[model samples]
Target: MAEFESPIVMPKLITFLSSLLQRAAESNDINQSHQSQKISVFHGLSRPSISIQSYLERIFKYASCSPSCYIVAYVYLDRFTQRQPALPINSFNVHRLLITSVMIAAKFMDDLYYNNACYAQVGGISTTEMNFLEVDFLFGLGFNLNVTPTTFYKYCSYLERGMMMLQPQINMSESSLYMGISSKLHLSFNEDESSQSHHQQQQLAV
Candidate 1:
């Protein structure tokens, strides 16, 4: 079982993640790539007004999952996009994708965690819709949820690099410690994926 890293102690990681996602959401919003790419269930009719950073902080404050779950969730989203290149993370669908990915990551990483209805409430979506997303996410990823140690470190390095892009002066070696990846990859993905995210497969991880 994966040990949980409480949210209270992970404000830095949360902020770093929020920054990266904020950039992606804003850039994707301007481009609106769905016209050229494949659209999936995650494309909302209207983009939610809340900023991606605020929404992510809300999830961090409320969902109470471990910090590493955020990283693991990123990995899941990246894999999902790799397999389903059509639906990248745009503003239209980032929140739903985020909540579902975090919730599923929580299920796989934490021995004790929230149920679907509770997660649905936190995610600001109906339980029915959350349930639908869960199944579709699993299918979209083809149940390839397990992450090897190598893959886990790869993602941690990727995230650190992304953070470095936003903060160029930061040293890469120190950035790893700054992002708090100095420790082991705290993850265990037994459950299948459940979420939304996109871009070209190459841009998926942000």
Candidate 2:
């Protein structure tokens, strides 16, 4: 099995993931798809002022979970969005959704991770709120937290392809990078997911 990636890779992963998410949320904001959307547990009364990249950076720097947790958390978010298509990833709810997703992913994927209270602190919400988010999110996911190796590989492959597709306008102002994923998840991929441990540090995405 391949060894885990060096800790040096975390920042780049964080940066790349942030850019992709920011773009997704912005696109959703423009669509404003669910104008009559009922307030779900993930929605905030108002959108947060913090940019998506900065919010993700705060979680990465503070949550400090294994590098793979970021990717796993992203998978969780995709699942959640699929499970609840009415509630897309928009600016208003993205911050809370991020904290909740990352927290759950860290718990499921990491042997050692901070508690909900700690995650809440990092996410600028109360521990009670974090707890609520977790429960609601789990139920939203129908309690499916286990990410199969095949599924993980498929996501990584698609993200890399998406990055390649969007490679033109990529500013990459920061030296850091990690990878891409989706707001649009229906795309097909030709990668062989029948390879590698999901926990192994992958060169493609975290």
Alpha-carbon local distance difference test for all models: 0.68, 0.68
Q: Which ranges in model 1 have alpha carbons more than 4 Å from their true place? A: 1-9, 33-35, 161-202
Q: What is the lDDT, from 0 to 100, of the residue 191 in candidate 1?
A: 26
Collision pairs in model 1: 88-197, 88-198, 88-199, 89-197, 89-198, 97-196
- Per-residue CA lDDT of model 1 for 11-54, tens digit only, reads 54566677666677677666664445666777778988887778
Best by TM-score: 1
Q: State candidate 2's TM-score.
A: 0.73
Worst 10 residues of 1 by lDDT: 192-201
